[model samples]
Target chain A: MEFDKGLIGGSTVLLILSLLEETDRYGYEIIRELESRSDRAFQLKEGTLYPILHKLENDGYVESYKAKGERGRDRKYYKITRNGKRQLAKEKEQWEKFSMSVNKVIGGELYATD
Target chain B: MPLTKVDKFLEDVLSHIKFPFVKDDISFELESHILEKIDYYMEQGYDSEKAEELSIRDMGDAKEIGILLNKQHNPFLGWLLKITNGMMIFFIILNIYFAGIPFISSLFSKNPINTIPKEDIVYKIDINDDKIKKIQITLNNGETFTETEFYEDLFLFAWEVDNEEQGRYFNNIKGYDSNNNVIFQDEY
Candidate 1:
């Protein structure tokens, strides 16, 4: 199936904010979460992940603070803000409405006589 | 081969990005992330060359991502930066007005200053008061002078005599008694 870059790019922010809402995550961990949650179907590149994370940070939807992990490498971890949580709720509602509408149109074909 | 591929990918991505205020450490972390992704791809049975290309291709547009990252991290910090830059420029101009112009002008001042003149010259005297009395003079190689009453202040009397230039030579001046009292006398 072909992927719509714009749609994917647009949804990426909401998807990230949704994930971050559950808990704070570092860059690598967030990428790992997306892949593992999607069952390896959604493979995010580092470039894609960092930029989205950066944008979310710039938009005031997320914040980052540094912590030194076991490897002694300082990791920048991201957390969702109140605004980000609110944005996620709105996006979730829209997605549900959209999917329900699409399902009605698409799923109805399964029941209809061919 | 993997390292070379990562290097090539880094070069390609770095060329397109303009991280105006981003620190080097952040850039390094980004590189590490890319390298890790490359390693993951390689582990998944992709060859080094293919893995490198695939990783970069999956990364999407660097510029777009960089812009988003900037927004997420700072949130309108660009505007803050612009305002600060304007303030910095204004301060530089203000500094020139306050210090630079005065410093340069003082360098070429018309009244040049030197330290030696202050210490080398001396002698300041003040004459508060002087009085003169009636005077008589006889001219000779040495002058004879007489005064009816002596003045308490002598500097003023000398000044008056000098101004008149009447005595051929000023010397041997004496005070005289006007009635019964000799007020003063001087020889000069």
Candidate 2:
């Protein structure tokens, strides 16, 4: 199912950072990995990814370098920095707490006994 | 080479970005991404033109992406930095013009006072009376200056002498006519 744009927007940075945590990835690689991991549910607009990547770079959370890809073509690869890893950890904790609280509210089991 | 649809799309996106330095890199990256997508689609049995069209379509609205990219670049910060750089250059030029060259020239001269040619030096005592047509003054430098050169040198001499020494400095001045007859002496 397609998610709301606003809903997906808040978590994109966390998702991107998590992907970059494993290894360096270029723009297309990031998008493909996101889609594959989410089972094609998160079809991010390819153009919008650049602004987020560029923003992450400007904030010093990520750094980019040009390197040859599998096709022997030069590609801009983004690598998460130390700061980005810390940020990802924080976001993950927050998401876990938030989602648990949300599940509790919507699960309707908290007041089921009463 | 003639412009392709992809080139037009890149141009449309890049035009909104005010910062020039980052545009080329952004264009190259985005073009590469689109080309890769087109290749992916062509492998899935789509024709070249169809794959190109689909690839561009999946990138989303060009104007929206451009505006978002512009926000990341922050044109305001870029312009502020540029303006500050320009102001710094202007101040450097102003300093060189007003102070640096004059200081350097002064260093090359042996005596600063003698830097002015002897003929350019003049001392003047103004006679406010309308009847006084010709007046001359002899300075400590043994230079005699007539009324004709008085106006130009008046400001130069006024600040050099204090009020207490004004009368003593003017004691050597004598007024005379075209025939060289002394009209007034030590009366000024």
Predicted structure with the largest lDDT when compared to the true one: 2
Off by over 4 Å in 1: A1-4, A108-114, B1-4, B23-26, B38-188
True C-alpha contacts between chains kept, each model in order: 0.61, 0.86
Each prediction's whole-model lDDT (CA): 0.63, 0.81
Supply candidate 2's per-residue lDDT for B171.
36
Provide DockQ values for all models, in the order shown: 0.32, 0.61
Compose the digit string of candidate 2's lDDT tens values, residues A4-78.
Answer: 898789899999999999999999999999999999889988999999999999888999999998879999999
Q: For each candidate, what TM-score against the reference?
A: 0.52, 0.63
Q: What are the per-residue Cα lDDT tens digits for candidate 2 across B22-128? A: 89999999999999999999999998888888999999989999999999888788778889999999999999999998898667544433555665444433456
**Candidate 2 docking class:** medium
Weakest 10 consecutive residues of candidate 2 chain B by summed lDDT: B150-159
**Docking level for model 1:** acceptable
Count clashing residue pairs in model 2: 0
Against the correct fold, how does model 1 do in TM-score? Answer: 0.52
